[model samples]
Target: MFRHAFRRFPLRVFGLVALAFVMANILGGLIGTALAATIGLAVFLPLFLFKILMVLMFFRFLMSFVGGYGPRRPCSRGRIKDRLQEPPAEPTKEETEWREHVRLARKELDELFPDAEQFIE
Candidate 1:
């Protein structure tokens, strides 16, 4: 649906709508707070929260259309073969050393405080 619009209409419309949505929410929140204080906080709080939530959802929707601010690329279909073709990344020396240190510490802890393990469980 959006892809069709992107093809037909200028992309600027989407950007403008997103910006307007954000500005409206900000102004609405400020006005709502003033109204709530004069009338009652209870009514204003929910309205404020709702407007904020709507703005957040609108921003997320806009981000999806914006391609995360990068060059848009067509998505590719995939299978397990694609995953298998990529080699696994190797662990760094620091990571290996950290794991070994943890193992040794655990071993020492087990010997030094068997009761500690029982308490943890």
Candidate 2:
């Protein structure tokens, strides 16, 4: 019965069915490739970002040490420490105010808990 019905259809129907199958296969393959690419990006993108960030951090570390502000090593004779330890700079107004605040806070704490000192240290 199906062959009889199929015979009633023109040969164009067979060609159309074949073309539809080919189009569907092509579409499926394209979708599969897109999904695979999406998955690859999802897996590798963060690793790539982390690699870039690590490179940036390494450069920052190198740059930080490039200036004279980085940590210094002692000289063979150990006089580097002595030479580097110059007289302290004069305190600014903010420093003086901070010191006064700390002194008052300490005095108040001492008055509040004279016996607390025994527990300290």
Top lDDT model: 2
- TM-score attained by model 2: 0.50
TM-score of each: 0.35, 0.50
lDDT of 2 by residue, 1-121 (tens): 9998778688778789999999999999999999999999999999999999999888766756554322453332355566678787899999999999999999999999989978979
Off by over 4 Å in 2: 1-10, 68-121
Cα miss at 66, model 2 (Å)? 1.0
- Relative to the true structure, how large is the alpha-carbon lDDT of every model? 0.78, 0.83
Report residue 114 deviation for candidate 1 (angstroms): 1.3
For all the candidates, what are their Cα RMSDs to the real structure?
26.2, 8.0
Q: Considering every candidate listed, which one attains the maximal TM-score?
A: 2
Poorest 10 consecutive residues by lDDT, candidate 2: 68-77
